[model samples]
Target: MKKEIAAVVFFLKRLIKKAEKLEAEKVDLFVERLTVALQEKFRGHWYTDNPSKGQAFRCIRVNRFHKEDAELLRACVESGVQYTDLGLPKELTLWVDPGQVCCRYGERNLAFTVASFSSDDSDDKEDVTKKVTSAVERVTSDYHSGSSSDEDNGCREPRYITGFSHRPPYQQSLLCHRMAGHVPVFCGDRGDSRRHVVLAQ
Candidate 1:
């Protein structure tokens, strides 16, 4: 089993190179990081039909972890240390999205939501233009009518996110993304259903 996991890791490293070849910029790998250089490796799959890397790593750790690791996990979540707040290099930031760590496990019975989103380079300028225009119009109306708190607090800038996970229907790690350079969001949200499969021999 360990050998099989190792092979999957090795295969993902090669797939990362393939993703790089498809784009010009050096990509961010959100997988396992080296303790030496703080470099992360790709730990996911290549989507042949779509632009994505699927997060489906089998967790041997679940079956063979130190007994105290659970306590550590619980503590980390309680500390409110958001991994997203760790101002990493943008390249590295886009690699993996870890489950929001929490001690209480969430259920997997939620309705699965397959989100249809655009890649950063997707030809969706019209949509963006419409959104921005609508936002401006709303703000303008509110300001004219004196009905918004923004007049006192100032308007908060619209936060623009390039890519977001189309979370799996069942709260599992079965979800994937369509990122530039074909990078995948290789981790589960909330660590719901913990399962992985070998997509290749």
Candidate 2:
């Protein structure tokens, strides 16, 4: 009976050691797989396909080390704008605007403008007037559309205006017609000017 008990204890110890070795090997293999996958997925055009160059893509920022979900955190940071796990099992999703979409990891302070067009119309006097009027109406409507019609409720509609100066003579000619009165124009220092009629309120 003593011999049998000793044999059982030795066998259990060996089994536990083997299990631990296998678990370690499995973890190593998983990390290798994850690294390869991340390299293939998040690899950008900025980096040439030379491993010796040791290039990291510009979009990813590594914050700190995490032992629990190290592989997952690495993958998320490499692919996403920002990621936070906070001791959770999975990473959290972050919101980004259109201007923030194409920025590098450390370029969060950058600002950009995005303008939309209605149709294939040209930027003539009529088009400019329509756009200016539309902008003003939209702003006013958004502010006062849902207000109650009470005389005592002092609500004011918003206005839109643009100023122009120091432009080329020919460019200024295109802005105001000789027969028409003073027309508001959207002038860019680098590009052509757009002319519009400012509606008198």
Best by TM-score: 1
Error of 2 at 135 (Å): 58
What are the per-residue Cα lDDT tens digits for candidate 2 across 1-201?
Answer: 112112222222222233343344433443344445444543442222332232223222222222233444553445441223212211111111211111111111222211222234342545434433443333234223433222224534322323334556575556533312223333234343533334222
Q: Which pairs clash (backbone N, Cα, C closer than 3 Å) in model 2?
A: none
lDDT of 1 by residue, 1-201 (tens): 222222323322333333333222222222232111111222333332433334222121111112222322332244433332321211110111131101111111111111123333353545534433443343233334433221224533332222224444454333333211123334333344443321110
lDDT of each: 0.27, 0.30
Please give the RMSD to the true structure for each candidate, in Å. 19.4, 26.5
Instruction: Sum up the clashes in candidate 2.
Output: 0
Error of 1 at 192 (Å): 30
The segments of candidate 1 whose C-alpha lies over 4 angstroms from its true place after superposition are 1-44, 48-54, 58-105, 118-120, 123-201
Q: What TM-score goes with each of the models?
A: 0.19, 0.18
